[model samples]
Target: MLTRIVTGLALIVLSGLYWLQADAIPQSPMSGSVGADGLPKLLALVLCGLSLIFVVQSILVRQPLAAPGIPEDDQDEDDAAFTRRGHVLAGALLAISIVYSVILPYAGYTVAMGFLLLAVGVFYHRRMSAGIATFAILGAVVFHLIFITLLGVRMPEGIWPNVLAFLHAHTA
Candidate 1:
């Protein structure tokens, strides 16, 4: 019941923000038939619909909810544990992303992505050697192909750009 209520409230807030952003979206040459805001608006509408359904179901099922199987004291402990783990993972990911953004301008796509992937894998407790090797190789290859080769999108070229360029030239 509490979960449902909280989820519904979050959905409501997100939907409102999406709607407002959609409304404020300016016209652009790149605007396709649906435009920049279409997908977000559609997603927000779906979330709102789901939230309404959940609210209605919660209201209809008027059963007094017991504290989930755990004892009340244990439940608080479990919740805290869960929250701490979530925060740790979230913070790690956020830090990696921020570093990627900052370094991309200097390091170029391949190196920056390699570092980001390695950081994320290590942060998640993957075996260090395997994680670093796998993510570094995979991230560099995949993102280089997608953004640089296929999409023709420009990526940052910092100190590491020459290294990436050399690799690409030889490999290609």
Candidate 2:
């Protein structure tokens, strides 16, 4: 709840900054359509709305400040198990992310993104492994299409330079 409120307040502040910056954008005298500031204004408004929602939700939820779910009974074994499990999970995730960052250039965006997404999905929902893999791969593909193909962002090709070459050729 603290996290929610903090993030909401931060976003609200950022949205105000965005609004100020957007208003400073020069309007085109010739163009009759929406000016350069239109998109930024819309984005600022959306951010403000979402942040307000989060702040309201956090306030209404009233999350406890203390360490929640700590048993008062003789449950040392349970607590130890929980702590060990959390430590192991967090350590493993940290290690995986470090490796992901290191090998991202060598593996290329598609493979790296797919692996990252799949790892996260599997970590969260091990029972739906196949669905998670499919979703991750699909998401990676869509991200690649939007950033690499449409936006013309240059991602490292690594082992699959031909893929980017093909995309560039087709776009040309």
lDDT of 1 at 25: 85
* Model 2 alpha-carbon miss at residue 40, Å: 38
Judged by whole-model lDDT over C-alpha atoms, candidate 2 comes out at 0.85
Which lDDT tens digits does candidate 2 get at residues 38-63? 89999999999999998998899684
- Candidate 1: stretches off by over 4 Å: 21-50, 62-83, 124-155, 159-172
Candidate that would win on TM-score: 1
Q: Quick one: best lDDT, which candidate?
A: 2
Worst 10 residues of 2 by lDDT: 66-75
lDDT of each: 0.79, 0.85
Backbone clash count, each prediction separately:
1, 0
Model 2 TM: 0.43
